[model samples]
Target: MSSNLTAHHYGITVADLDRAIEFYRDVLGLDVLDRFAVSGPAFADAVGVDGATGGFAHLDAGSARVELVEYEPEGDDADAGAVNRPGATHLGLAVEDVEAFHEGLPSDIETISDPRTTESGATILFVRDPEGNLIELIEA
Candidate 1:
């Protein structure tokens, strides 16, 4: 028997669910689909964390769904790894115009670089979310 897999959603652990939701909705233009809180045994068992509790938000990123979660009694802060680091991952978003998108970004947004064309003919750039999670914007 073979296991079947399909893309459902991408999840990011955030320090603040509310702020993350605002950034995704207002800054990146993703639509807010749903928001809720979870806890107790079922949540703990699913996540493999004891006494787990958190808030979750699902955002619509065009064809993709992005999930943001903030856990209570939060863990220690760790550096959000660079793209070159082992085990580092980033969510790539398709944009209509990379250059224009970069230009309109808030001054406080931390961008890895200005929009640049890839050898494959796509324009792309990296930006960090308010909590330092990396996100890639690509125009093909």
Candidate 2:
């Protein structure tokens, strides 16, 4: 790894682009920067799949970008069963108030855990997105 490397964005594959966009944009308050429909061998090679085609949306999330992709006609619909397991991916979003943020979430969004204070006095909570992806809310 390069010593000067910095994270450009975090990519997530969602089953529904519109729903994910609503959750990340409208609900989470991220701004949609760009959207695209991708296909062909170059994308397949980049993603390490034999064939790749999808709906991609790049959203601005504070200092970082959230890349939401919906691989249509060939994407996997496997349910994310547990967040504790290895290789399970989750996003940690910083908020001003964890409790208030949790309370403001849509009714359809599921709460996985209540707010708990860390050793550093930061409040943290877990919630699941519309497609069952784990999201962590933190307030320092």
Candidate 3:
């Protein structure tokens, strides 16, 4: 590993690229940076999926970047898995007010629970994207 390694973008595989873009951009308020498609031998080798092909979009998440991807010949439509499950991951977003942010979310959005203060004094909550990806919102 390199000594100067820095955090890069986080990638989420989704079933619908367009829908994901709308939700992350319009709902989460992330700015859309770029969108593209990928395929061929290099892509397949990099992702470890044989014959993998997909469409992807890059979004600006303030301090970090989010890459949303949709594979061709779609996979099974299973839940993204619970937060406690092994191999599951979530995207953390910092907000000014967790409660106010929660209230502004769409009525149909799925939230793990109401914002609650942590032992460290930050209020936080988790919400699921349209594709069931967990997103943590925190107010310090």
Compare the candidates by TM-score and give the number of the best one: 1
Cα deviation of 97, candidate 1, in Å: 0.6
lDDT of 2 by residue, 1-140 (tens): 65987888999889889999998988889999999999999988888877778899999978889999888466557667788788898998999999989888888778877799989999999888888998888998
Q: For model 3, state the Cα shift of residue 36 in Å.
A: 0.6
TM-score (C-alpha) between model 2 and the true structure: 0.90
lDDT by residue for model 1 (19-137), tens = 99889998899999999999999988898888999899999987769999999768888778789988788999999999999999999999999999989999999999999999999
lDDT of 3: 0.91
Cα RMSD of predicted structure 2: 1.7
TM-score of each: 0.95, 0.90, 0.92
Give the range where candidate 3 is weakest over 10 consecutive residues by summed lDDT: 72-81
Candidate that beats the other on lDDT, 2 or 3, i.e. the better one: 3
RMSD to true structure for each model, in Å = 1.1, 1.7, 1.5
What overall lDDT goes with each candidate model? 0.92, 0.87, 0.91
